[model samples]
Target: MAGKIRVLDPDVVVKIAGGEVIERPASVVKELVENSLDAGARKITVEVEAGGRRLIRVSDDGCGMSQEDAVMAFQRHATSKIRTAEDLYRITTLGFRGEALPSIASVSHVELLTREHDSDVGTKVVVEGGVITQLSSVGCPAGTIVTVRNLFYNVPARLKFMRSPASEFNYITEMLIKFILAHTDVSFTLRHDGKDVLCYSSEATGGDLRSAVAVVWGSDTASELIPIELSTPKVRISGLTSKPSLTKSSRSHQVVILNGRFIKHQGIALAITHAYQKTILPNRHPVCVLRIDIDPQLVDVNVHPTKAEVKFANEAEIQRLVVEAIELALGRTIVVPTIALKPQPKPATVKALKRAEDAFGKLLRSKLQIGTEQTAQTDLTASKTHAVTSAENVVMVTTPETKPSEKHVGIGISGGELVDWHEILMSLHPVAQLHKTYILAEAPNGFCIISQHRAHERIIYESLCQKETRAKAVQWLVTPITLNVGQAEVNFVVEHLEAFSSVGFEIEHFGGGTLVVRSIPAIMVNQPYAQILRDIISELMLEQQMRTLEELIDALRASVACKSAIKAGEVLSIAEMEQLLSDLSKTEKPFICPHGQPVALTITDEELRRHFER
Candidate 1:
């Protein structure tokens, strides 16, 4: 015998249904704001306490609901945005499912006060946990004000999973940024815990999108953005995108608005990123606010509960338009290369300077003997052993001694015999630079190719990890750079000021969102400090904000190495290439770069013979 299935209680069913529409405090804010927008509200005010867990109040100047409709607004499946079944296919409003008001009312205590412009009296309705507790006529302005309190009180499970107040506030702030940018014509004011955090007046008759973007992303970032505009037979795309010079470490700043509604469409995101593939570095995302206007019939907005995702009829067409618009906009904008600061000599103590001079003498003497091109090939080939196909032929060398005056000039030998390998990598004469990027060298067996940038990056990254190397003398700036940033970014930079100092950057707050960079790492003096500092800060804010001091130093070190390393197109002399290889061989992890890219590869003689059909 099987147990009989029973229907859930009416109260339990409503609460369960509410969970689908309202997952967190940010969801509640999103739904309410969209409703206000749909009501044709030109002016709106949003206030929250305890990150919307304690109270949320939204006031709008749109036309208020009538007495009869006010009572029906909380009932399931009731809505004013749609009338017939066919209306679902073409949703022009930000919300049309009619699930927001009722679902929200089911999970919290709701108070609604409203009045019509022609009516003398208004209606006030109070609801708690899906029950109508009170209703009456009242005197009020010709608008609507909905206040929600004790969210998720009826469902303890949901309340238990709510994030911290600060985390919740960040999410609410991010959601509002999207809405504010999407509907620039509507004025919005947001208050948290009695303090006004964000305020945006309604745009003028013809307002630039840069003004709106500046309100959230700071004016510095907005000024660097380029306007993207494109029109097709069936679509019109217009927005602002950051120039290739201004990229972000994360995709958080990219906003996509479709048909005046904020959405998260992956196809559109991919198109925007693809446009920047050749301009920006790998793993970095561009910042853009793209608005796509397509016929309502060609899109389905009801696919997701939150309506953040939409299904396009022809996604490929939309993608093509987006890519073309961004590419065209970028082609018109000029991107000048950043100029590096003047090079400066590194300061050293008396004893260290004496030892360095001795090391230079030793290096010069060894170079004179082994660096001759003819001697290099003959001596290297003489050390080659027979049967190169044996696995033991690949010999591993020990990490080079770091003593300044120490030198290993003789070929590595075991049992008084000339082995097939040498300890010093500089002994293998570098043949030439391959396209000015890779160091091509002839080893005892076959050939070794090393990526100059990746090799140098690994060396600098390991150097920053050691105490001796980090005692790195600093190069003081003659004219300090004063950076002005937003309040959020300012706070982040100030908090991590000490972390910056650990990696050989000297910075001091100059009051009111301004910081002066007084000095930088000695080795990086000739690199572009302005761009490198900003990039490091942005990357730290994105991925390492919560990291420990040690972790932050390591992360910044890797970033500094990449920025200061030799670029691919730049030419390097033979001495510079030899120095790069020698430094690379001394690093802890020499084969791969800090980013996990292979630094060097070796082609054994056996494989070379097989390639020739031996």
Candidate 2:
């Protein structure tokens, strides 16, 4: 056989290259728009029909090309950006590969009309299936306009894979939004089916990122955005990040513009996420429009034809920069989310609830039993001053088993109720907090014990969902605390005092690099403020990089749920136990803590009889 790798046919080579560069109508729009931007276009207009499968037209008021250059632009690997090996390493322009036009023309009928800045008439060139069909001189505007008709006319396989018209149009709109965000100075207009679908006017924005954000996202998003600006010797990072209260369910709203082109870099994305991990609620992503301007020579954009991804010379440093900028902005802002009534999650289906009720139905056949062991330190006395009398208690009562189909009231959503635990727990009369670690109460189904720490954790986390959550809830300490620490720690606390203030610590600069704490978080009112403040400051010092203040604050708040929780061995009065039970009942998840630990357990009469062999 002839040499197996003999030169392939030109048409086959063209198809192979086109497949890599042009995947869909959105790909065509991205390439064409980038080309217009590279030409220094002040104002550009894009028109599409049938989601760019039938036609696509891009017109730009840029310095048009000469007659000779207009024809040469169609040739493969021909570009004005770079010509040598060294230039390839530092490609600056977006279309330096020079394959967009040739690949696009190879499958579609394309017409190019252009005129130079000083030329009297423009040049018109027609291309079909990568061949020159006609050429003429015509009177036209002092700019370039390219018309592409019937995309994938010769490539039926590619056309077959195109998405629905609306889906394809959405892809194009998203691409245009990225461009609009990155290039605020240049006006852009996108027309679909001859109707103006999206437009960004240049005169109104004055090249502001907020204006771009308002146009792409709504004005509400723009107003909530906090500006991020950080400049190093080799890196410049700028963007608009949402406040702690503003978050989204998906990362679709996040974009990173690197070196004038929007791209996907995993390290950069992770950096942004890591910064916001504790700042926003779990599973919620912050709306980000990060722009990284770095030296072009340090980036390798030649990894792919589409340039959707890039390789950075020093990715770690870039990630650090991203984190610091985000953290600095967040540290100065309050971190409570929008608070509303926290509705209880949907309960198990009726069948599922029945199964559970049936599994524990053995209790109904057993007699009411009361344990005499009081070693757990739970006082079972009637306290008239506590508002909970012994007569109102369910500990010694004979309660009929609730039918699985009976309607029960809950503290959460309207017309919604829990099946078992909620019904039993809310009817509980507070006996005492057991050993100061567990809570003992007289439930309708005998008695139940609750883990004090775990119950309080659920209460704290659920409070974040309800009204007046974590923002500015202050508890003035009876005595001001004066903490002595290393100078660096003191300086860090002083410099980032807003971080402490936002989390509800009213601290003032005490003389000689010490801080005087006058107030503490409402949640930590029972805890020792001096020790906790020391621990908070000490933990902050261990962080080598600039972690988001909110991240650190979140860690502290989470720890508060544990360290500040009612200890197991500590004693609880009847009144405190009553209040704790009431607060626990109000939470969406009264049975589980934020860490998935069980908060409460029912001591059924059946189980008690089995222990005593009654």
Candidate 3:
């Protein structure tokens, strides 16, 4: 038998390596954003159409490249940041690998327009599938504008794996947010399809991360963040942490950066979380932005192909530092204002007036009592009042009135009323509200309680979930919305077209890697379709290797529930609250939401009495 022959082409090797570099539009985004940062760009503007499938244009007012350098940038392993192996140890620039440009160009149709400040002329280069189709000198302003299109066009297999535009767009936004937090000195703008999604102006307060966070996340959440600064010989840690009251249900709000590079490290995240173990409720994550700056030699960024994960030389020490810093910061007392009670007037009586006069002596006491009496009549009976008096023995006399039915009445309990305990308590019929959030109704020995909002959420969540599963209705648009996507995303849509239809999305592929959305699911008609499609694609792509279609569909439904659920602090009327409580009582798992957060928490009358020392 003849020996088996094996041949490995260099082009095949290059293409395989390229796959690791350019995985999606977000990958391209990461490279471009890093490049802008490395070039010392103070302001970077990223504009994407069709979730960066049709076009991903990054314009930066950084030091642009020369004609020769622009042409060389497309070649594999070409970089200005590193030269020899030793240079890697002290690497500071974000795009040192030099593989980003060539890798991106190899997988997409790339157009580069760049000009240096010193040069009057600019260079324009166009590359498709690693082949340079055009290179010319042109007149242009100083800076760089990189436009990537037709991603994964040559690799049909890879193209088939791209996520929906909305999903991709979210990923892009997440990446942008990371960069914005990391570099507060650099102004960033993100525009999608001619509409601006985010705009951040550079802060004058010496690169405050809080300002950037306030711009991206709402100001309400950002306002609660407290500053943290710590330094040691090996590392420096600085950032902000949200107050305990502002914790979120998910870890999405936490932002961690290692040496100005955004990273996803479970160790560091767990360290911060462990520090806050008891202070924050279980399942609730604190909002934080932590930046750790250590010597470059101590970190190995090369460990991950995406460079989003790094290995630290002294992880234990780093963890200790992070934990200690967070713990110390949280231990400090925070002053929150309490409602002030209104002052009340003493009852006018000869004996009371004589006692007051004796306490304060004649002249001062008489004047104060006269002023108090004048203001007493203006105070409404229903208004809250606080009384200041030295006389300990006080009595109120009132005529007995007909008692209402014990089963129907609810009254507030007073401390002194316990003397005639049985008679007063039986007549009062005061019901306990759990956590001051729900009412507990008595029914002989065993009692049923009602959840105010959870009941409402459960009813709404189940009804929506059922509607989603039974018969999803499509809301057709009079005018179709067209979105440009990468060739890969187009392939993904084609592969999952039937699934999309099942979800009541009327989408058809337009020529040249574009999708025209004619209708959305009736449930999501008001939602941004581009964003919804992108989210669906991302969900599908993330679990493509691990889950079946049915599992993915379930995950999608959960996401919809999470998005549509009524948030906390929404005021409800008595009828609405009652309806919500009734619905919550009907749910199988009435105590918890789908995300595993407590829908309602109950504190019994016994527990309340213990707390109040009753």
Residue 533 of candidate 3: its Cα lDDT? 68
Q: What are the root-mean-square deviations of the candidates from the true structure over C-alphas?
A: 9.3, 17.8, 18.6
In model 2, the Cα lDDT at residue 46 comes to 88
- Is 2 or 3 the stronger prediction by lDDT? 2
Task: Order the candidate numbers by lDDT, best to worst.
Answer: 1, 2, 3
**By lDDT, who's the top model here?**
1
Best by TM-score: 1
Estimate, for each residue in 1-614, the C-alpha lDDT of model 3 and write its tens digit: 97688676866776787899888899999999899899889989999999888899999989999989998898888899999999877778777888888888877899999999999999999998888999999998789999999888778898777866766776787788889889999998888889776678885535677767766664555777888778999799889988776665567778899888999999999998998897877877888999999999998887778888888888998999999888778777474745435222222332344544232233222221122332233222232222323221121211124443332222222322212212221222225555655555442222344444444444434544565333423456666767554333554566567666655566898764467887655444434555556545544554444345665555555555444333344444433333344334434444445544554322345445667884
lDDT of 1 by residue, 532-562 (tens): 7877776666563335777777777888778
User: In candidate 2, what are the lDDT values of residues 1-614, reduced to their tens digit?
Assistant: 67777788989999889889988888888988888889899898989898788888999988889889889989988888888979977777887988988988898999999998799999999999999999999998888999999888999998778865655666677788899988899999889899776678878888888987776665656878998999998889998999976665556678899888999888988898899888666666788999999888888988888999999998888899999999988887776655445222222221233343221122211100011121122333433232232321212222335332222211211112224343455577877665668777776546777777677776665553343545424555656766544333444566567767766677887754356787766556434556567656644444424356666566555554554555557566565666567657655657667656667666666667779995
Name the better of 1 and 2 by TM-score. Answer: 1
Candidate 1 vs candidate 3: which has greater TM-score?
1
lDDT of candidate 1 at residue 579, scale 0 to 100: 60
What's the TM-score of each model vs. the native? Answer: 0.71, 0.58, 0.61
Better candidate by lDDT, 1 or 3 = 1
Error of 3 at 205 (Å): 6.9
- How close to the true structure is residue 424 of candidate 2, measured as C-alpha lDDT? 50
